[model samples]
Target: MIKYLGRDDNGIRKVVLNLFLTGDKFTTGEVYDFLDKGNFEVSYRGVSAMVGLMNTRLGILSINVTGDHNVYSLKESYKNIVGSVLENY
Candidate 1:
């Protein structure tokens, strides 16, 4: 498991990870909007960067390019791990 999963950022990272629990694909903009609607005060770029890190560093999310935007989804293999981490977070 990634050490950074829920270790910092006032639990913002954990909230972001929980977003993937739905098993739906989302672009950065969509993620930002969801967070905003949920009262999470984070920049759109922050969400983008976090998602990027989950893709490149954490290696937990898979990406799909659609038109000009990148869509992200939790990798099937990491779903359980993510769930467990969140459960214990």
Candidate 2:
């Protein structure tokens, strides 16, 4: 359900892992923009859903909801674990 982007796990995980590699906090829109640059062609809704799943299901990210924005970043404590997940993906 990576941001409900139609269950494209491989693509969604690639976007998430790439974003994680940056080691910076980013909003859902920022992620969407990055995905566009990577030619993922995903919608804002999809990015939003992906973020939620990444945080809740995968436990690889930490989310900060500030007013109307949700900023996400890799969970520092889970860095190695996330790296392993991505590597094995």
Candidate 3:
């Protein structure tokens, strides 16, 4: 988890992870829009990369490809772990 999150994330990763804690599936575009609305200074590609890393490296998100987008949600088994980690982080 530490490897995936890195040692010095300025709460951006945590904010992104908190979106998943809502238990709703979201495409990268949706995530980007959410972050943008929240005034987070992140690009769409950056959000895509972060979501990709969460799916591939962290093995925490379950992804479903819909058309050209990949909709992602936090896996049920990792919910508690993710929530606790975010809380403590």
Off by over 4 Å in 2: 1-10
Least accurate 10 contiguous residues by lDDT in model 3: 2-11
- lDDT (10s digit) by residue, model 2, range 1-89: 23433455557656566677666999988888888888876888988887787789877788888999988888788777656655665
Q: Would you estimate the TM-scores of all the predictions?
A: 0.90, 0.78, 0.90
- Measured over all alpha carbons after superposition, the RMSD of each candidate to the real structure, in angstroms, is 1.4, 3.7, 1.4
The whole-model lDDT of each prediction reads: 0.86, 0.74, 0.87
lDDT tens digits by residue: candidate 3, 6-85: 65457778888989997499999999999899888999989999899999988999999989989999999999999888
Query: What ranking emerges by TM-score with the best candidate at the front?
Result: 3, 1, 2
Question: Once superposed on the true structure, which residue ranges of model 1 sit more than 4 Å away at CA?
Answer: none
Q: Judge candidate 2 at residue 86 and give its lDDT.
A: 57
lDDT for model 1 comes to 0.86
| Superposition TM-score, candidate 3 onto the true structure | 0.90
lDDT of 1 by residue, 2-82 (tens): 589636657778878888877599999998998899898889888899899989998999999989999999999999989
What total of clashing residue pairs does each candidate reach?
0, 3, 0
> Which pairs clash inside model 2?
2-50, 3-49, 3-50
